[model samples]
Target: MLNEGLSARSPKPKAKMNRLYPLLLLVAAAMFAYAPFMILAAPYESTMGLIQKIFYFHAPVAMTMFVSAFVCGIASAIFLFGGRLGADRVAMAAAELTSILGLIVLVTGPMWARKAWGVWWQWDARLTSTLVLWLIFQAYLLLRRFGGPGSDRLAAGVALFGMANVPFVYWSVNVWRTVHPTTTVVPSLQPGMRGPFWYCFLAFVLLYVSVLGVRTRLEKRRAELEALYLAVEE
Candidate 1:
């Protein structure tokens, strides 16, 4: 009777989840389509012309990377101190998202910089600090994989340290004389450019939410399998 009851209850949740994936895919597809059209449709900059268009997607992706890192750091702190199973899964999901988004930022930034700055790369304050921030969370993932039994706690500590860098990346221009643009410049974007920038920001954020949901679900399943394995061993 208990086995029958468990089977009946389990399918209800699965049925509900089965309905979600198609909707997520549709939203992600729409966002992907919207991005390029908006980029091309936006008015050209008086100075940079075609090259300035990269800013629409590039800045928003960096912003998404920041959001992912912030989520990872917060979830890691909760898992370490609160010891909640849900928090641990969330931390793992957010870390994966951070690494993916950071890669996008790294790639797109260099592409944009090559045209704007006349070089492929520069070790300016903002750029260097942002790169370090990416490396720190990446190290967190590596430590979790190889650090063995108690590595989750160590990774959590690394995430907390990584969180500290977010501010430095944001204010690096004001803190030092650097070639990177400061936050102040954002407010002054011309209306034609601002419209596409904001639209791309909205699209990227929706994409982030859809991807994060799928990743968290996978992490939760992996945790459950590990728990089942340990139980069977015992």
Candidate 2:
């Protein structure tokens, strides 16, 4: 009897930990997210002009979008092979959030590019590949919404296939000629720029993690609500 009681209690601890994981992640993320802002007024002042300060926020947003897309691919693979409906929902959520972030990157990138390179838009490889990735995620979401029978499977396939562009986007500038700066941080080119760049980078990474966690939780809640609605209708 005691053993049975202990076994039951053991699971309670694990369940509690699982429930707290997201909250803990969010807290940790919040700490890092704001660290850069506490520093000097212009984090990128040493590396690029005042306008270049946007790189800190812009690069992280772009990187986070890549991460989210990669997660979608992983989730899609699990759903397809393991028949995990939860994974499918998670993929959909990540894809949606990634699309939103990608848009922010796209918009901010042009502004930064215009200020630094004197061009608002360029047909550079990196830019083009990034644009493709954005479109792919957008299409995946649309397919999920309007697709017919086997829609989930179709969307999963798209998610898996679209992930191919992620690497291309990351490597485009290196592999091909592009006006987009090669380094995410100006400090990478000049050691003096490292201080503020690192600060900003750390903060943005934390912010991304926090936002991703919140979005993931919202996605789970939305799924539960949908399931409940279907059951009620039945």
Candidate 3:
């Protein structure tokens, strides 16, 4: 009866998501093709030279990580307050992506820092805050995996905290003394360089959406399977 009811509900959104999967793949392929050109077209920095190319990927990945944390935090709040299963699934999916993107940011950051700063690590305001934010989300994922009972609430709280740190990470250079660049958006680069950065940024955003869509669908299927198992057990 549960299965029948669920079928009767006929989730039109699932169909739409399925239709969009191939479109996402196409976008990803285009991104891969465009990335090389974007990197090559951008002029090298006077001080950082060719190593500065990492900025194209590093900055955008950090931005995507922030976005993922924001989405996860909001969905977690919804799940905690409204007890919505869909929100829980979305939160989990976003959390997983957040961690993945965070790892990329951390890796790319150290790479750039090593070349530009003569060291692999620093305790600067932005760097430390971003590291702390990544660690907090990492803890959230671990809790979701092994925190056992009552872990969801704890994880939700951690996610919320992680979201709170994002602004501090972004504004740290401007607000405090730091070796990191103040702003990379405008007035920091030549017009030719801005185009590649923006293009790569858009690519990363599309990639995030694509991955999130797939992860959400997998979570939904897992939920459905659990429901079927419970019905069978009964």
Better of 2 and 3 by TM-score: 3
TM-score of each: 0.83, 0.74, 0.87
| Local distance difference test values of all predictions, in order | 0.75, 0.71, 0.79
Residue-wise C-alpha lDDT for candidate 2, range 167-213, written one tens digit per residue: 76658644665454443333443454456556656655555555665
lDDT of 3: 0.79
Instruction: State each model's C-alpha RMSD to the native.
Output: 4.1, 5.9, 3.2
User: Compared with the true structure, what per-residue lDDT tens digits does model 1 show for residues 1-234?
Assistant: 333323434367756764675676688678768778877887777666687777887788888888888888998889889987667777888888888888887887777667666677755554666687888888999999999998988888889888976786657643664455433222248777777788788877777776777777677666666666766676
Top-down TM-score ranking:
3, 1, 2
Residue-level lDDT tens digits of model 3 in 1-234:
357436733379878877797698789779869798878977878778787888898888888888888999999888888988778888889999888888888888887778766788755455566677778788899999999988888888888777776776657644564454433221276888888888888888888888888888788777777777778888
Query: What residue runs in model 2 are displaced by over 4 Å at the alpha carbon?
Result: 1-48, 168-187
Model 3: residues >4 Å from true position, as ranges? 8-10, 168-187
Error of 1 at 161 (Å): 1.9
